[model samples]
Target chain A: MIIEIVSWAAVGLILVTSTVMLIIHDWRINLGALALQYVAAFWLVTRHLPFVMGSTKLITGWMVVAALGMTRLSLSSEEDDTEPSSLLRGGWFRIILMCIVALVTAGVTTRIEAIIPGLGLPVIAGGILLIGAGVVHLGVTSEILRVIIGLLTLLTGFEILYAAVESSTLVAGLLSVISLGLGLAGSYLLLAGTSPPELENEL
Target chain B: MSAPILWIAIPFISGFIILSFLRERISPLIAGSVALILALTALIIPIDTALLLGSVSIKISPSIQFFGRSFTLTTADGTILALIYGLSAIWFFGTEASGTANRFVSLGLMIVALLTASIAVEPFLFAALLLEMAAMLVIPLLVPPYQKPGRGVVRFLIYQTLAMPFILFSGWMLAGVEASPGDINTTIQAGTMLGLGFAFLLGVFPLYNWIPMLTEESPPYVVGFLLWAFPTFTVIFGLGFLDRYTWLRTSPQLSGAIQIAGLFMVASGGIFAALQKHVGRMMGYAAIAETGLLMLAMGLQSSEMLNVTFLLIIPRGLELCVWALALSIIKPKVTSLKFNDVQGIARSYPFAVTAIILAHLSMTGFPLLAGFPPRLALWQEIAGQSLSISFWIFLGMLGLILAATRTLAVFVMANENKIWQRNESWTQLIMLGLGVIGLFTLGLFPQILQQFLVNLPALFNHLGQ
Candidate 1:
């Protein structure tokens, strides 16, 4: 009973964290969410999982590496560093605006899910649609910097789907790995600008 | 005491030690010798399974039957090890190529170690992680100065890393067939997983960028290794996964989905390669095209595709040598990869010019050289699949032939002037000769690698089934 409660609490924390992480658009905050999510996941995976332990460790190790990749996030956030990027100059507004729109849509769906019988599908669809929008924003843009933002948004959708269909050490394990990979990528996308200042730190 | 175990351990230990001590001068050279020894070990080791260090005995062939499933290594594993080591042999030789080769040798050894480890281990997910890390190492190597700062490397790393979770997720999904053993999927979960596994391997849709960035910035030889070796392992590993999950292989729809994804790669890779000029970048497109071919072969869902895989390796191997030899001479440096740079230089280096043409022609699949036969065979296979698709295959082939022609034109128009040449060296001629020799040898005896190719899938089927 005690173990069951711990696992449930862990799952709840992860869901809330995932939702909160998606709503916010800052790299630093997302990094924190990523770190917390992995730690919680490691806790989650260690709870007497029935399958192979080697498999569990290997998958989780990938997650930790990704979460640890937040170090790059810190390095890239510094100014006049490398790759003078056009996207980094002040392009946060449009993305922030999009997030706001996604949030409003998400709010309406949550309320609908309370009353309607089949509203769950629409809720999931809304979430996936918002992610597709994020992909489009990043895909068409020439500035690689924004793609990281796009990756973060897409991952948020994947995590939600990942969480929805299954809630166990395995899914948690996978989400953590995917999240870390996305984090590191988001870190690099920030590095894509070719401004002269960015080149020095790269080598 | 197994050769599989030892072949796995030595280079792995050497690779890590070499990387940790990368700043040391002799480390890489020593690492290369260690890798060479390991490759040799893979050759000599007879296939067998036993616990050396607290190993678990996984019985299937002769029946450890628990819900009617079997998994065991047949004697055929020896050939796979041989193939792994064969590629590693040349890569180990690459250790002697430059200062970078030392570290490259370490990474290459690690790659070998991972491949060796994956094959030995039971759960396919472990192999997937091993492959992912191997892909990740390509990042530091792919860093080119002119391309957008560290972003490309980071993006490559990020995208590859991102693939991990889904693979792990799928690993968990498929873990049932192996662990407790049951019908496994909760309906379409099997199909969804099969899709994710394919996505991870093919790097489908928006998730594919590392290939282009790495090819563009990487040293030609290194690009050559990745172009051929990594995909080969990935396909093998992916097949191992699909083979384990009965739903994927048994269902034609699942197989068709994979084929569609691969076909997309072939079409896009062809279009992309034709539009590019840099030799390394061009190699990337060709590789993408090859990935699609691998998929198409897999899509054929026949052991014959595996035969094509065997034949595939020879031309690709020759092509790598050809590309590496050609690129080392062409432009000679990043400052001048443009066609104009090599122009009039043929007047300065006649032997180099001829070798470049031969190399390019072979790489582009011209007749009577290395690339011709496999391409012809590939056409036959695609035609066998569907004559309508042959148009797409031919169009793709045309794109490759056209790319080759463009590259050759770049050389010819550079104004061949052997009489005005300054000088030539014996070693350059020798390496060039070896590449020429390899191309011709494979071309003349399209059956040179036939024996080995025929043996491989049978082996994989034996182990996997």
Candidate 2:
């Protein structure tokens, strides 16, 4: 019973952190918090699997891909550093985010339990965390490219919640395809906006 | 099933050929001709047998499933295909590219094909995919050279992508309920799914601004096609989901919700259009209003509603074609798409001005034109529900007419009255003649459309119940 409670609480913690991070538009801290949230979610899902090697592989594969994706994202941020971070002064936004997250997390937790039998508390708690992390990145970020990457993470979290009900294979597969499409489109939009050398005079 | 696939496939294959091999000289002509042929075929498709393909077989009807999802493709999809075929044809003819129009054509065909796929494919997942593809494909068209895609396209795409998870999760959730241990909770979950999916796909409240912004950036003809046809297809898909999946119509709340949405659309669209300075944007608003009207009609579900909606199609097509021609002629003259740009164009070309007036009036569902009968039927249907709704429709109609009057005023203002030097060629004469004939023919014989309109309702009854 306590194990279930803790699992649920972990989800609650992640969600609260994420919502707080997002509304405040605090990407740096939110990034750390979001990564940790996913880690906790990964632990929750895998801690008691029928433990199929394939499910294990799928979960691990997603984690590795996600890690690599974030790494590349961070590396790419080298250029963005040239522009000051938009959220450096947004402390009040963070506090307000915390209040909203706490209220929503509490509401969603009970609702999930009521909606889906046996798995409500965990599913609700986890869905909040995943969605919360993504929303932060989306709401706060000004860099168009970064926001796209943030969207992918947010969707990934939702996939986890959806996975609680259905198998991860179907949910994850469709999501990956959608993310790649989004990322490609975002990259195209971003590159299109880059200042060309010919425009040196124009600027 | 194959026939529905063909509705999407033929244009797709033609688009591929044009984009790849025929890029040099005649691709645009060839592409336009093919669209014309497809449109004609769709028009000629015998309403007696709604589905063009011989058998109206159903492979998936939301009852059966594989891998945690449902499927629903069948004969009832004919009207949607017809809608797509007509819209694409108009767009194809309406475009003229000096260098390469094939990419845009390819994208258009792909979008149409995906829309048909979304209609015919069951499980709603296919619909979401098509929606994604449709949104992504617009990137090429929306992000042109001069306007480097300001926040509008970004906002539009993000809103579109955001709708995806709601739809997918809803499908997943509904399936979960279906698989539950003999529970009544399934119904509520399914309802939530429908509400969320419909809201997401239709761009229901906050997310709908994309339509106008899209108009702000896109080629007018192409945007017009998207404005007119794509939402109609999505609405049809949404309506089909309601018809095939559950007892959505019987639920007064569900139908009432749709009516409420329709009311919001009609009301907001009118007020929003009034604020716009661009003619293209105005069309966007008008399309939104038309969408609301279609939704209102759908909500009524008279055994006659389907026919009424189908009847609504012909007038819409005619309105779009006339608008497309008028705009296509005007595109080169104006530097910007603002009303101030073409404020008095009506005085310059009397015939073009007349066509514009009639088309705008018809679009507003004005009297004595092709657009009136359906609006009349729609108002009559709404009146049976409640007088307040009837009053709303009446006011909406008046607002639409006033909007048309504004357009007329703008066109007249744009009219220079200084004889412009464009040649009056045989083809121009033919097009003008076609436009005039299309507008007045139905006005003279309303029965011509009423016959087609009568058979369209009752195409799909609630199958699952």
Candidate 3:
């Protein structure tokens, strides 16, 4: 009973962290929150998937963060002149908006449990929240890096739910590969957007 | 060796090899020749039956087991493979002329291989994974070395990725529906999910906003190839679903839903094409319209549905290649493909101008062009069923016609002082000329392709049989 309660706490943390990551625009904070989100996801999924397989998800989530970070470092100019990463331009207004969306999504997902019955309620609710949040993130932002983050968040949510339902090794591996590929592609696009236009051909 | 391994592995391996070694020089010719050879081999090699050419017997088995799944290639697959590889050869060969030979051929070959794998993979839900991988692979091609990815590319990726979960989940639901045929709720859920999944994959109507964006941002030829390849295979994949489920096939409500969806795409695509300022965007709209036609063909309950669908595929492929090649050749001379930028370019590159006009006319179903026959058949089928739907579809065709006419007027409106000149190289002239001729030949003698088209339905055991 105690273990189950802790697991539910982890699930709740996943929703909180994912919402926070979406609400916060700072790359560092976003990355940190992503890592935490994965840990919580790993915790939830560990009940269903074997430990090794579950660890693959967490390891891959970090690897993606690492890939994106390295790309940002390599591509960011030394003479950069922008405010350091923080809450985006609209600030708390956006946060409030996100909170409303989260609340609405939570309500909708809670109701959805009636239709798709066999799946556990917490897993479905958390997964749907992540999916809904990721989509909302994509809808709001046009930045390549942010969109990638949104896509990854959405995919992570899907993996959490999908892992509960189907435990095929091949699928788990393939999904991990897809995650890695998306990160690498995201990094490439980020750098491409940053590169000098005249020197584009050389790249 | 099994046919699946032979077809799938060889092209993929060759693609990687070309990317690594031969891309800098002679890439187009090598890639083109390899595709042509592969297509020819697929054409000649009888799948599932031994062939006798001077006492030697040769038979290729259809299925190969890999990673505990099946990849099967049947005799019915031969004609389809031939069509895919043959059209690919056209794209590959034209890459040199279009000046996008470097990465286009290498990645193009790989994309083709992966799409073919999607068709062959058994327990076919795995196709969703392969398709996701293919969508990822397409990113580098869409966004070149230092070029930022466009809205189209990102949206395209998002939409394609979005399709995976819908399809995978539907497959799971479909298994339940198949197990319990009497369950109406499961059936409705499966059908809705399946429709949405395919709508995303095929870029139906509202979900197709990226097609025009992609055409504007990416190289016309590469975008054209994607427009052709992704939808053709997706349509087939959808048919496979219909083939598998009798409940789905017999559902009148489901069929009506498909028809309405198809009509919406046609009407929207055609009307949008008419209003587009950019030629590349026009091609995108044309693609959406053609996809709509294919959807309409699929929605038809007539016995000739598969034949009509396959018929549209060939001509549509040819039209896109012709249009894209012409655009690529014309692009270097202009900053953009807008009417003002390219007004009266016919004076400079008459052959390309002619090819573009012909291709667009064909797409609009002008007489004695490749897009005529299947369109006529589709119209007949729809007209018999519902005159109102047919009339709206006709309005869509009228929109395409208007766009083509406007394009021609713009092309021909050059200054009288500028001398008429053949700016295209002999190679481009030859390719454009041949494409034009092929369109006419196929249009005039469509019977030449009837044998292949008629036999395509045989691949699906009980589908529309």
Candidate 4:
């Protein structure tokens, strides 16, 4: 019963953190939410995967957040200052969107649970919530950093669900590699995107 | 050594080595040489068969184990590996003349290697992960140093990454479908997921807006390489799906669905291409149209589907090579590649202009050009099936022709007093000339590719059987 309560709490935490990520404009708070989001994802993943294997997702997710944080730190004050104000410039609309996403997640969780029989209700709800929030995040933003974050979120949701399906060590390792690679690519784009353009013809 | 080690690992490792150790000027030469050698070796040496080299017998095994998984490159894969690497060699070699040798050659090699691995990897579902890795590698290549990533490049990454989950989930469902072939619900669900996955990967119809946007944002040469490489591999990967699933291939609705999708891309791409103000975006749309033709070839009911597909594939590489090389040469000379900026460009770079026009015409299926014969074959087959399908395809072709005509008029729009001069460097001229000659040769005598096409279908064990 305790484990069940913890799983339900983890699902609730995921819903809150993912919504925070969508509504918050502050990078630090956003990254913090993402970190907590991973913790919740790790707990849910452990329900299906072993703790040792599931921890990779946590570690990778934290590392991704760290890498992006460092990239953000390295940016010049002027470059960093270009970001929009905290609490998102049209925050109410995002909140409404999040509510809609929540409803959809609730509606789809039961169907997904029926389709993939072995998954528990909490796992299905958490995964679908993350996916719904991620897609909404992607649909609304065109920022490079946010898009990367959104992709990571969507993939995390997939990993959570897929853990219940296939558990090959190599597949797990490759997926981790891809996560790290996306983080590095995001870093590269962040750094490159901020730098001044070179004058030479890029033929 | 095994074929996977030879084709996948070596080139991949060499890419890093070249990036780190070699001088920028010599990197293309070394990389191009290595790719050419690999292609030639694949062509000359048979995998999984013993070769008597003057009484010293040697065999190149087809599969190699890695991390409890296997990557198998059998004899059936030789023609494709050769074609991919050989075409890659051409792209790499031309980088020097196009002035993108430094940034393109290394990552280009690595991208090709990863793509090859995607094809060779068994359990096949893993190919999605490998393709995603390949797509990630593309970001660095597309974005120049110190420049902001454009919406196009970001969208490209997002779309490519998005394909993974759908494909992986579909593969899981497909395994279930295989266990109980009578389950219609699972089959339909799996099929829908698979179609959505590929539509994103191939940039079919609605999802392909990034192509033109990317062309507008990046160099013509880099985008050209992507246009040629990504779709070609994705098509082959899609073919693998058809070959592996009996139910999928035999589904009565499959051919018509694929045909309709192909026609939509062709018609949309062609119509859009005709309306584009920028030549780069025009090329993007044309590529979309070409990819449509590839899909159309796969939709053919005849056993000759594979042959017609290869016929279209081989010429596309050469056509893009010529067109891109010409554009690269002309880009620095003009203010931009927009029609207004390139007005009367032929007066300054006659050779480059001519090459561009010829490549454009070839892609429009002009007679005596490389894209003509395969297009003719496609028209014949489609006409036999449905007159409306043939008519739509023809309309697409006419749109492309109108695009070419507009491009020509723009190029030659000059005061009669303006002098015609060739400004291209000898290397650029020579490469462009060779590419043009290749296009003509393939067109006038399509039989040249028959040998390669004959055995290409063997890669798909069940398709067209």
| lDDT (tens digit, per residue) of candidate 1 on B1-465 | 444445665667777887776654566457656755654544554445442435665311311211122223345666676667666665455333322434566777777776666555545565655566566555444543334544345455545545655665566656544444455443356457556655655656445566777655656666667667766777777767656666556768876777777777777777777777665666667777767777776766565666765566656755665566556555443365555555455566566566656755665567888777877777787787778666765566567667766766765564333457534456556656666777788788887676566567665653223
Q: Candidate 1: where are CA atoms >4 Å away?
A: A1-33, A39-203, B20-36, B49-74, B95-101, B144-152, B171-189, B204-209, B301-303, B329-334, B344-359, B415-429, B462-465
What tens-digit string does per-residue lDDT give for candidate 2 at A100-144? Answer: 655686777777777666655665566665666566666765565
**Top lDDT model:** 4
Considering the two chains of model 3, state its CAPRI-style docking category. medium
Cα deviation of B252, candidate 2, in Å: 1.7
CA RMSD of each candidate after superposition:
7.4, 6.0, 2.3, 1.8
Residue lDDT tens for model 4, A1-203: 89889989998998899888898777778888989999999998999888988999899999999999899888877765455674567688888998998898888888888877888888888888888888988998887778888998898989888888988777888888898889989988887755555542432
**lDDT, candidate 4, residue A183?**
90
Question: For each candidate, what TM-score against the reference?
Answer: 0.73, 0.78, 0.95, 0.97
For residues B122-173, what per-residue lDDT tens digits would candidate 3 score against the true structure?
8777688778888888888888666778899989988888888788888888
What DockQ results do all the predictions give, each relative to the true complex?
0.17, 0.22, 0.53, 0.64
How much does candidate 3 score in TM-score? 0.95
Considering the two chains of model 2, state its CAPRI-style docking category: incorrect
Report lDDT per candidate.
0.57, 0.62, 0.84, 0.88
Question: Taking the tens digit of each residue's C-alpha lDDT, what string does model 3 give over A51-122?
Answer: 999999899989999998888767656423233454566557657766776687678766666766656666
User: Which candidate, 2 or 4, would have the higher TM-score against the true structure?
Assistant: 4
- Fraction of native Cα-Cα interface contacts (under 8 Å, chains A and B) also present in model 3: 0.48
Instruction: Report the poorest 10 consecutive residues by lDDT, candidate 1 chain A.
Output: A115-124
Task: Give lDDT for model 3.
Answer: 0.84
**TM-score of the candidate numbered 4?**
0.97
